[model samples]
Target: METCSLPRRKLAAPLLALLTTLSLPTPASSAEIHSYTLPQQAYSGSRERHYKVYVPSAMTTPAPMVMALHGCKQTNDDVLNDWGMKAAADRYGFILVAPFITSYDGLRNENCWGFWFEQHIHQGAGEVEDLHQIAQQVDAAYSIDPNRRFITGLSSGGAMSMAAAVAHNDYWAAAAPASGLPYSEDSSSVSLSGQCPGSATFHAVSQVVSDLTGEVDNGYPIPLLLLQNKNDCTVLQTAANNMRDAHLQVFGSGDFKTAATTKASDTSCSPYNQNNYSCHRIAYTQDGTTATRSLVETIFYDGPLTTPNAQDTDHGHYWVGGAEGNNGKWALQIGPSYPDIIWDFFSRHSRNGSQPQGHPVIVLQGDNPLTAELNSAFSDPGATANDLEDGSLNVSADCSAVNTQAAGSYSCLYSATDSDNNSTTATRVVNVVDSNSPVASCQKISASPYAHIGAGRAYVGGVSSLRAYANGDNVDIGGSFDTWSSVALYEGETGKWYSQLPAACSGTGGGFVCQNWNTTNLNHVTAGRAYYGYYTVGGNQYLGSLPGVNSWVKETASGYFQAGQCSN
Candidate 1:
């Protein structure tokens, strides 16, 4: 979100020309920021929405992608050029997309995204659908990874980023809403000149889940990073804190404490404070839990504006810590580059929690039906497999047990093996029922980028982790050890269940549970379970309303690697 200095649409002639020059994408022969217009298939208010994507030179075909939504009065060009996002693409080898509002004629000519518009925030509606369509289009054209997709925005765009994440939880692995107000149901958050009260934007923990009833109930569990600035008069720090707590409740996090504080001045990141903001990484571990888990983090800044060639420092609403020499309006060159910060968080996650590298990913071609009628014709829906080392592997299906002759349960195992001889399997349990009607799959979709924060973490020992997701309908949901009663890891393939860590679980609500260990001084966790809405509670198993993917991630390194997100 650029153009925070002075009034919107009132920029002088020379500045406008400079902005025009800066916003243009560099020559395609080098790196590129190509623009396109996507037709609006869902929304009636607008005919089409415009967006631009930046594909770095020599990027991998299935590289991750992030959608950067700009603030009102800002164009996609500002994001790619002014904010150093394009340059970051060169370094990170990831695609960057900036979405522009159909119209920018805002109140005071500061028009931006429709943060207050219900159509934009809710799914199956207007703008949110448009965004999803845009993402699907990108995937079709570029073959971007469905699991590693991300979304972010500034100011009003920030509000949309977080809000849209709620409505379309299945699409994004993670979301970073930077330098924006906590989103509830309010229009005041978009006011650049006035401070929006936190009460209007922040929701209580109890209300957070309730307020997001229809959506959260049927979507993937996604982690968030809320970026804020303390020195800004437009949006207050209280809003950021309220938002942090709000999301913790959404994630069902026990308690988050400030674990580390790093100033750009303390490292080589910002020796001269070129990026002048400080990041406070928060950890969810408290009460004797291992220290590696983090559900949500607040990358905040409270400092004098010393950006290289920034338009002004009066408003803290701009990108706080960005690449040096922003030299444009609405972005401060204070703090380390945010692209690295956001990318770090984005890299560790995908649509199904953590993606195990080199493993063959098997996708079921037919819907995993939960129920079938008695004495009926049953066909096994087959699957396909793709691996990192082996381009495409064959998936063998065994559905011989799926007999519609009697009313009971049947199972099919989809198996795939990569070139490295590492094998993986997906279990599809189809319930042969007493009724005549065909089994129906839930209309809503969901994904768990990480089944829980610790689902795919590479730690030395059994890691303390949390798996909290929307439990609209938990037929046989059991993993939620509402309390840290026992540490357990069950391998369905091996039919082996063992005690692994202490656990706390709360359910019939969100299937929320915590698996904790006393220390992080152990080896990489060998405990993980693949979920496809199938769970067993008290020996009775059930399928959830929102079925998800069954994928595995195997990583053996701690996730302290440095990375991008133009967060705050």
Candidate 2:
């Protein structure tokens, strides 16, 4: 319901859900730059606002919008150009809105986003509220995609972006705060607001969110890509660390899980620095869900130093690595392609409830992890499809690609479409596996139970300890007793093979005495693979398998049988 234009949002879309690979029609961009202004509020000394918008050349209808906020002493025009965001806009087809700060205290003569002002910190009040209104007005003019709206900025711009996200958490799809500070109880105080490593002074993301939207919870946790330059002098690494901790204080506990990736070291990135400042990415996502709505991902770029912004003396502080990347001011050119990264992260998410969902449904009619005997003929179980607009639909299954003659996993993809060209696809894995093979050996031995022996050993289940060694070997099992378990020294009358112990074995290990007729002899057998049991006579021994799936040593081998091959 919290959309760019609530009137045309959900009702405008047909029953077509967003396709995994959507083929949306491209719209011609107006290529016109437009500017707007909003008179300051009745507040004592609030200044009027100025902002600009640029629609990409080949933008998508209801396109996404990115609010490019500038750092201290920098104007919106500088951010749109010097940060290489305008070029990104041209390439990605999103509406770019650059917000300029007009208010200046008596002391400071530089343009800066008022992230720490008491009025700006709260939603629907000051500078932050003005930025929000600009977003709404841009959508009113261009019909922007409500689900894809985004906000990102440099130093102070970044801090303001964080505030904007918390204040209007339901409005933005994602926010990337570069070298920005987290919300603090002392954020209103200019001196204390500059404190780093919010561990001691920062407020929990939940707390500020609660403060901003009291009794109005959207339940949509804002996804964030916290950016930092490891070599940044203006904003120390502690600030980034504290920012991370504050978000984690709320997202770290429950369904969210943390995963890490190492940085890539490339020496050919920027002329300024000769080291690869590949992003050290730490992503946190909810359990059972991936590819979208990330709780937080902290990226540390340790690249070469570059020119500083006019307001500060910090290098490696700007957005890095774009086709037209700017390193003149608060920009770094050697690190990761931030534009592409931001777009990719932004594309994965949308406002939680804003997604239109009358899409056609196609559900496969069979077991998910299905299986067939090795080299056996298989048939597609097929699927049923239905749509809200088109009603019941004919479903087509692409099962010709499934090769049952080969052992391993294949998929049967089922797809369906509504009258409106809205379509969906479903897939089921068809695992072809080998039938259980016998674990026969050369001779019979102990009858005592050994816990180490597992499945596939079941292939020779019909054979008993009392049975003579008939493995094509002429050796006769010498039993002066009634049975191997009941009586004597189980030695072979013909061969010297015998049990190492005088006790009786009751389970599958009893078959180990027989010769193992395997692939070396016949071509119908499959190799057992990937760990079921570590059989050691005493302790610590050797074992082998194929790898990936097929734990033939397990008792329930048929159930977990996957990722295996059947061939000579």
Best by TM-score: 1
For candidate 1, lDDT tens digit of each residue in 1-568? 2221111133445323212222322234466556666654534434377788777775765777899887766777677766767766665567887877775322433646666665566776566666776676566556577778899887777877877788788677888888665544466544345432322344454564455654564545576776676665556676667666665555542333232221111112221123234545443422324332245656765644322232343445676435332645567554545665665556545666544345565655433444667887887756767664565689999989888887787799989998789788977778987653322211111222133113421111222433332222212212332333322232111121112211221121222121222211101111211111232211222323222222222211121111111111
TM-score versus the correct structure, for each prediction: 0.52, 0.51
The lDDT of each candidate is: 0.53, 0.55
* Candidate 2: segments with Cα more than 4 A from true spot: 1-30, 43-46, 105-109, 185-217, 251-276, 288-290, 308-315, 353-568
lDDT of 2 by residue, 1-568 (tens): 0112112223322211111121222234346565666556554435677777766776656677898788876787777666666766765567888878866554332776767666676666777667776677566566688888999887788888988887788688889888787753343322222322222245555564445445224567778877787776555566666565555544444534233321112122211122236656666655524433567777677754433233334344566644456544566544465665566556556675343334565544444556878777797766767553455689978877778788788888888877778778878788887655332222343332111011111111223543333222323333212232321122222223233421222343432232222221001112322211222121112233221212222111121221212211
